[model samples]
Target: MIESDQNTVITKINRSWSVLSSNPIEFKAINGEINPDDNSYHFAIPVVFSESEPMAAVALEISKSHAVNLSVAMYGLDASDLSEDEIIDVCCEMCNVFSANVCNSFSGKNEGNINVPNKLSSEVFRYIFKGSNLERYYQAENEHGRVVIYMFDPCNYYN
Candidate 1:
């Protein structure tokens, strides 16, 4: 995780929103000017952050954005049953969900947008990082009405 500026954290979501609206795919990479692929990308998220801990902050954000607590959501994510392309498409759905949510959620406040939050809470991310395999993932048909993503780990392998 990268170091986070206190002031920027609040603005971070908004910045991500602007970037997504303007360029959904590349915004995350260039916004923070990070390497775009690696552990650091974890730090790109701004929500559910810790006061002085970048790693914890990022972890929290990922857990929230990914809705790790929604593990039940992955109930149907079995890789054996899906083709590689289907899995990739799933991941894209997840990305788009998060991306658009961030943008539409905070579209006006400028306080770091993430509009797709349906009763989102920080407690949502408070879980252990149980590495996921295809069979373990599931999708929740949140009111957002978007498809869930089961991607090829784009955050870890950019380009």
Candidate 2:
């Protein structure tokens, strides 16, 4: 096997794990224990693919504080699960807004840069991105390819 230095994926996952393990009361929402709202935020969940077709995509829904309204799916060699209006950004650090409280969506496609449109409402997002399933939600190996774009009520370890 090949061993390389630490990377961004590892960082995001590490932070996400901390988000879950820190306090069960805080991560209870992932287990459906608590209903996420405008305050609740989702961490971890990531896409696992490059410019190629993904094997599977998994998303964690938070009832308390979720950015995307309805789930979405992208297709083709160049497709995305993100909205067309939601802001799309990139990150080099670990645990970015991708999981915090901001009301948005995120992906980890490593082929090229994935851009969400601009600022589409959740309602428009549902209809525009509607598909069978999101191809870049979260996976095992590919999960690390994602980056934090937007968030809401996130738990910052820096604090």
Best by lDDT: 1
Give one digit per residue, the lDDT tens place, for model 2 in 1-159.
Answer: 011211343345445544432211112111112222223222322332343543222223232112222112111112244543331221111123233321122233232222222332344323322432332222221211221222111112111
Q: Model 1, range 31-146, lDDT digits (tens) per residue?
A: 21111112111212233222332211112122222322122234354334555344333333444455433322321223332222222132332111222111111122333221
Off by over 4 Å in 2: 1-110, 138-159
lDDT of the candidates, in the order given: 0.27, 0.26
lDDT of 2 at 132: 26
Model 2's number of clashes is 20
